[model samples]
Target: MKNFKTLLFITLMGSLCLTAQNNDTKRADKEFARFEYVDAAESYLKLVENGKGSDYVYGRLAESYYNIFNTVEAERWYAKALETSNDPEMIYKYSEMLKANGKYKESNEQMEKFASMRPSDNRATAYRKNPDYLPKILEQGKKFNVQNAGFNSEQSDFGGTLHDGKLYITSGRNDSRKTYGWNEEPFLDIYTLTENSDGGYDNPTLVNSYINTRFHEGLVSFAPDGNTMFFSRESYFEKDFEQDSLSRTRYGQLYLFKATKLKDDWDEVESLSINSENYSVKNPSVSSDGSTLYFASNMPGGYGQYDIYKATINDDGTIGEPQNLGQKVNTEGQEMFPFISSNNTLYFSSNGHLGLGGMDVFYTKEIDGKMAPIRNVGIPISSNADDFAFIIDEVSGEGFVSSNRDGGMGSDDIYTIKKLQPLCDVLIAATVLDDKTREPISGANVSLYDDQGNKVVTKSTNADGIAEFIIECEKDTELEVTMDDYESRKVALQGTSDEESPVQISLSPIEKIITPEEIVLNPIFFEYDKSNITAQAAFELDKLVQVMNKYPELVIKATSHTDYIGSDSYNQRLSQRRAKSTEQYVISKGIDESRISSEGKGESEPKIDCGTNCTDEERQMNRRSEFLIVSGGPESQE
Candidate 1:
């Protein structure tokens, strides 16, 4: 009887041990299904350390590491899994992981082997074509380490809002009342989490049901005083309503909810009536002063399927008419999830413009009631997946966004992003000037040329008689300065350092004969019938040609004026012909064709003022030919 009793006890102990191992395996599987790879990995490692699992254990551990982006460990376990089992899933996942880590050659070999095993697999075919199937942007550091908010798995913890050392996220994980069908994966309810001294978040607790409900809710924005809150909520068919008005009005409707701080807790939850039935609004962004509200909606008369609109808040707490931000801000695609920073710069996500693949975050500044050009935040902040819904901590400069790209836990994951301050370098300045009078000449063109004579930047000076410019040049750069009558100047500088290092240039003035002492002639009346140059005019022009021939560097602006006698258009054409004739005569005498510019200011700039009707002397003054000393030697500069 003693021997039989000892045997029975040993049999029961063996059964209990087997049951415990099975239960452990089941727990790991459950964690994996919930996309909790870190926890699942811990469980799998425990099983491996205990040495009580099948080949599947090695493969599962490898997959968990790959999901968490531990490439070295993933490779080690994948090799171990291969030694135990030649499963196709394990092989494919291993090849993908190798490719993701830039081991393309080895990945190709594994892919070829997998293809041979499963010739009908289209995924294998894709891998064979492009073994390094990872996006270039992802390789440029788009992926980040994600921290799971330790809330109930059944809750939807998203649309996180940070204000005054607290984080408010939406989660439906605890809503026991099933009054509505889940629109999002598991639905959502609003919850708040406070920050601890160590910069970690405390466990999230549910806000009052006045804000959260059995229905879907998310996207909270707070006023500066923290007294008012704006959020989005949707009512579904399962909710009890007398007239089903919520179905028509509140379905996918974003409502504004407000609460007052009572002692240490927020109380007095009330719905704000600032919406209409014509459009569904989401993503509310209040201006820094809290006077204007910017949100995304799909209303009529918009540039795209969905656009961003702005409204003014009245003193009585009512919203003004929503104004479409015009085509400059709105695009022909979906634009949502707006965030207005303290600087009044608007940041939002859009799917309408060129991007990696999915929605990308873009920013534009509001300058004097006009929006500046929108600019992409570029790589690392954007990816080849839906990257949206971001918030920045004002003091820490740390932020987070959502992405579902290649290297995440599942379909979507929250990622933390920290701004990296750019490196600072030295400042440089370059200026161009006329060598003679030292007066800053307006419209003087300057070009910075390279060693190969290729132009870099063409710029003109400002009105301060100084054409000041800043450039970041490590070595010497050649510069070329030229104007209409001035000789082109070229200079080169070497070993110039410091921000305020002066690069003052002096261009020698080109010599010319169009000074005040040159030949002069006024208008010569033709007695109502004339088409030839008069004797006095010919003599004056002869002197002008002599002046032109003397100075090849001079450029004369010859203008012809006409009286308001003939048809205005006809007189204008005639004056233009006369001016061209003078220019042609100068060119015929061997003067450079490029040195002269002619124009007809017909019946304009009369020496004496007159009404519609004018005296003969006034008409004579209007019908004269004039030459201004536009640019030349000493007196022209004066």
Candidate 2:
């Protein structure tokens, strides 16, 4: 009887423990589904401690950490989840977490695995196309100067937008407000920073209590007239949510709201028609002319978890149907926080595009009524951590960017950004080669000159024949190369730095075809039956002029001949005109006219001597010119 009682008690306690774990798992899942990541993570950890760790629990834990931007915890849980989870998105998120933690090699391994699993995914396709994009991203020139804003608090603060001189941002620094389960920070509220006389911001204050609620509120956009504003807030403010019938869990989403400025405060708050209880619509951005409203939403048929959508603002104060920004702007990764500048450039944040890591900011501008391919806004504005909510003033060239990168005072800090320069620094790389052998030429001097003929810098070609220079882009520049026993060559830099291959420049040897009696030159071409100096004729004549200038006492006699098509008398006159034209060209190049003489041989000096049976090749060879050095060489004769 005592053994039986002990067994029954053990079984009852075991059943009760299992029941408790089941209840805890359900509670944690409810929190996670409601976006309460902080509480969900804690609950899931407790379940793991109680020996209830499954693949589902591990994935939920990993995702909870990821949503909170806790890279360390996220990476740990993702590794555990991947032991049994085959989901490609999980693998991608794992890779992102690894990158955030600076495990780039490990991150790449996970990315390759993810790409194999989901080859058609946009992110996967992008990876397969360029597996080694990190170097290019890191080598990109800096575009903005970033500095920590003084008003940042110890908690998360981001989503900065500037209007009229006042800076507005979403922050979680209210110690008096209720803390959110997403991060242990207080519920987010809209705060304003007034610009001071020194072009700096003053202390932050709540924008308006009526516009803010106990739930999250921020990410504001102002109309051009400053009389109205659109912002985001949790749907709970309007008592709109979906309740799970069994668990009574209320799931709320961020919704868009608009308010009108009344007297000193804002009022007349109302939700936009686009907000729905089934999906989120947040991060409102108004166009400069108030003709369009851009926002991020996870509504039905989106390319990613949240895609940026823009709707026309009807003149009657109603919004039109939202339209997707298309695949060029919306990838199969999260794209959010769309900010349209006065110049119609759309700036947003995304992880789908290739970048340094995490969510990098990107921008696109309309070209000929079509949106251009998006380009990453590159570092100092982006980093290994989550960087989003970028806004810029096109006129002032100053703006604010939000980042959770290292060295910030909080989880996500808003940094003031100033446009230092356009992304106009170009790396000009050239390879010098021998013209005769087509082999790399080492120890060659390569110099760069600006459009103003100012010498920028000089570098020597290495063993592989490479000389690199970084110069200001979009400006005309020249590259001049020289080497011993090689003719100096100068070429204008043609295309922009987008070309990856080094510019190959072949240099000819300085040894021309010269003999003791004459300076041999290539055939100088002329028009049919004409004596005008063609471009080819001038080029060959320059060689003769160069030889004459080298030895001041050198004299040259130019002789010209004609093919047998013309009569001898007519051929004589044509040949004489051609000879005189060559002589005049040398004189135009500053050669002494008296040193160079001319003579016409007509058809009498035909080297081929084919006569009427002459082939075209024989006739071409018959029409030629000669430059004889009458005086000035070791074997010269007077």
Best by TM-score: 2
Model 1 over residues 343-424: C-alpha lDDT tens digits? 5667788888656778887666664356655655556777777877766654565776766566655445556666553111
| Candidate 2 lDDT tens digits, 588-610 | 56777689888888998997999
How much does candidate 1 score in TM-score? 0.47
Candidate 2 runs further than 4 Å off: 1-131, 424-638
Estimated TM-score per prediction? Answer: 0.47, 0.50
Question: C-alpha displacement of 330 in model 1, angstroms?
Answer: 1.9
Residue 245 C-alpha lDDT in model 1: 57
User: How large is the C-alpha RMSD of every model relative to the true structure?
Assistant: 32.2, 28.3
TM-score, candidate 2, is 0.50
